[model samples]
Target: MNKSKWLYFWGLLITVAIIVISCHHLPPSKSSVTIKLSGWGGSPVEQKLLKQVLQDFEVKHPNIKVKYEVISDQYMDVIKTRLIGEAAPDVFYLDALEAPFLMSQNVLEPLDNYITPEFDLADFEENLLNSFKYQKHIYGLPKDYSTLALFYNKKAFSKAGLDSPPNTWNELRSYSQQLTGKLNKYGFGESPELARQAYKIKAYGGKIVDKKGNATFASESGLKGLNLVIDQYQKERTSVLKSDVGASSGSDMFGQGKVSMVIEGNWAIPYLQETFPQIDFATAEVPTINNKKGTMVYTVAYVMNKQTKHKQAAWKLISYLTGKEGMEKWTGKGFALPTRKSVAEKLGYDQDNFRSALVAGVDYATPWQVGKYPAAIANNFDNQFISALLGEQPLNQAMLRAENNANQQIKMME
Candidate 1:
């Protein structure tokens, strides 16, 4: 044979050999794919349960595997990077605050196509569901939620001779005054930096922001809430920051007996149980503002990247995680409230007195959304509000400054 023909024949033989060897070694060219599920870092406790749940899912859906990726910090930075590079996970945890931005970008896969009647989107709380929806299509699904609760030391209450938790804003004020110590041990306190916290208002139907994202602090109701917080420093020096309480959090103050009472979230439950095991405490719904119950509701949801290669598989995981049985397992540990109503009952979450208050709060509490420009609004509000809390700025002036900053940001967005 001619030299050229001989070389071509050898090349053809080598190509066929490579194709056969590659096929033989490849792992069964899996129709079953492993999807990546990204979320913020969690404690060991959370990891144990989550790993178990993921394993359970793998067992049931033998064709799919979930790769858990915990993003520890600068969550958006990493997520944005992956998304821009089209290397984002199949599914990721999206905060309600950031969901609007992601949804607006058309980067999230709308679960609508994957949602079946069996998925039961109706089973989830409407308000929380509203937070995940963008332009009338649901973009994410919440596996769990958290709500603010009034936590008070029973020993402190006994000292103050209070028999029951305060039910209204006036009662809260009265209780705070009565509980104030002659020294550093204060009567009551809360995280002042979180202004839109539904539980942090006067009992007068006060709101943090209007539908248009305008600051409501200048309103009479807003002033009342600010005044109540302002009085904590001026009226008495008893109220302490959660940091001062020898605890890492506001709820820690109540747990360590630094303050008689404080409003915080369910996250404090495990912290107190693990850190300060001896504290006697009771939990109740936050005091009613404006004769109506109130509490801050915080929620996060599983969002799919628009750039994902496995849209269908990504959605199966989302549906499974937020579905009734999935939600039950996700929130079954009392670590958080289930976003779905049925799972709340199935997991006996409604039976726990303290935890159950969060169930009621789901109906009345405000969404933790501070609008599209959360960072700007939160930073300005927190800075000015802290100044107000420390008595550096008068309540009205501080609020005005915060309002101006936030409005200026919004106008700039416009």
Candidate 2:
């Protein structure tokens, strides 16, 4: 009775211990994954908002974790370097300006396969979405965008005896004359960057680059539109650069009462409100040129690195962040304007008095992208266009030289 019973009891105890140890060693049914996301740093408020969004994303997708990092400075250069080394984050912000180059480099994952009909690709502003498309493949989804609009100081306009912002380029010029009263205050604030002036070039059928991707903004049509800027600065003497008024940007010039009107983007709204709350200002769609309406639209998109090891989790993160609900949160504070038409309507930004003008320009706005050599084209155009405005050279000659120089630089890069 004692020996057989003891052996049976020991066997049963050992079997139970083996089962417990095996269960402890077995993998769980669901494992958590961590994916890295990166973007250039924004304002502290924006960072806090992004953190909250990420927290919400984690709550919705508990099996996936996000590791967010800020590149802080030289965002694109750092991102490109990381991409070349195959050390980039699974997801990162890619400006439309840089998207053309990256999309052509085959380092980004084409998002077409992941995009389902339910994603509602149609809801994105077509032009904004097209900025991230190359060769019929969608490489990224736009997260936010901003469009140029006429930002006028309401008090300044009232003081000038003007009832409303100008509706045409001619009206703008005439209004400038009336608004320029004090020596310190100019009628219009001008930013002579290529991104700002590209639309003007397009106003008269000018192309920024030829089919070969060489700079070609010095043509007859180009000068026809650019000459308007030159005339306003050199001949009319009504417009002033921010530097002339000791301000950092067009928005600052308007905020400081150095200019009555300035063409700026949605970013200026919060900046003006926060930095110069005492000033009463309003935004209007940029006035028409050559009987055609136009403005510059800037956008940035979320793209996935082709080298990411966790593709499924990374796509989940990307899809959520750029999806309808997430975009609503990102743009709700109006730090940036929403890219999705539905989200914009939901946020009521399309009807916002300050933002509606920006939204209106979307239909006719030219994206601030010029093929894959924007940096070169922009540098040359800005350098020469300012010279033209300053009367250092005629507009035609300056643009011609700029086109030549930009093309030379592009050839070298090739």
Candidate 3:
């Protein structure tokens, strides 16, 4: 009720009002951002491991959240459609086989500008990293990869009195003949698809596609390499297709003791171990073709959308997922081999008995990308190549037909 007390109360009220107005006018604090990520469906275990990695990312970056989606089938088709509609995710998985087309489409964000020195761009394998590069701009970062290797059953080798895996094309044929009808119905299981045979085409200085994206694998050099496969299957009768053994895949036939040897990728390791635990097997670099070592390498990368509203956050997610720590966790279980040299060395894959051959082949392996239009080339080649393998036509005739048909389709696509 006194004058002095009333004055003090009024001053306190004015100070409180000034502070409230100042706080309201200041810039709002940074808010959390949600980035949408999409990828094709993987195995249950792989899905779980990825979820854990995302959770860790969220914890590390409290301001960012991730929304993940899985396109179960027709993944590339769905992604292309969504990209055209401008409704694609901020980040998505891009297979090296499909990278060329997308990288050239202008719909992908070049990560080169965003990549920092701490990211260690040089840590990636040159071949794998180059798969996602277009015009010297990096469009994506490879997360993992697999190179084909020769897998042979130890028990079957013992039965055939073969001490080790074949070292050359001729040796492989001789080994196949010695093991056929004694260890299993077929000594070697063959996949007649172009993906498995492209390296063979290259071993003899042949190319799968020209610079302009046309099929050209029917040349003399290409056939020279391919004849090795045809001779073993048609003339020697030591090799059999998966269908011949009533198996779904090469690994399946080998696991069931229907075949003694097979050429497959790293994926077969876990499948065989869990599917047929009792089957003892060892892996070796794919036997040399014409005295030149070669195999096919497959890889997938995490790419950013050019229209992303959250570029920084998306880059963070990609870098973390492909970084050394995250890659170690993802590849530690051996589902897929690491693409980074440091990660592979740290994991001891080079010393692993069953995985060493697969690791070693990365240096000389041919990547499984054949220019911008692969489906056309692969489908035509597969159909005609199978026809040849089944004795429906001559090898040269079948390859010529495939090459012509693939070029026509590629023209339409262009």
- The candidate scoring highest on lDDT is 3
RMSD values for the candidates in order, in angstroms, are 7.0, 2.9, 2.5
lDDT of 1 by residue, 1-414 (tens): 999999999999999999999999888755888899999988888988998988888898888989998889899989989888889998999888777768878778887888888777788899898999888898988878887888878777887888999998678778877887722268876677764443455355566667787766566666776676677666756566765556666866666677777877888887888888888778898887666677778899998888888888888788778877777787878887889887788777777867877677888777788776677777777888878787787878887888788888888886
- Summarize candidate 3's per-residue lDDT along 321-407 as a digit string, tens digits: 999998998899899999999999999998999899999999889999999999999999999999998889998999999999999
TM-score of each: 0.88, 0.94, 0.95
Each model's total of backbone clashes: 5, 0, 0
Candidate 3 at residue 35, lDDT?
A: 97
lDDT, each prediction: 0.78, 0.91, 0.94
* Candidate 3 off by > 4 Å: 1-27
Candidate 2 residue runs with Cα over 4 Å from true position: 1-27, 182-184
Ranking of all candidate structures by their TM-score, best first: 3, 2, 1
Candidate 3 accuracy as lDDT: 0.94
lDDT at 28, model 2:
79
Clashes in candidate 1: how many? 5
Task: Name the lDDT of candidate 1.
Answer: 0.78
lDDT of 2 by residue, 155-249 (tens): 87877778988999999999999889753368999898988999999999999998888999999998898989888988889999988888988
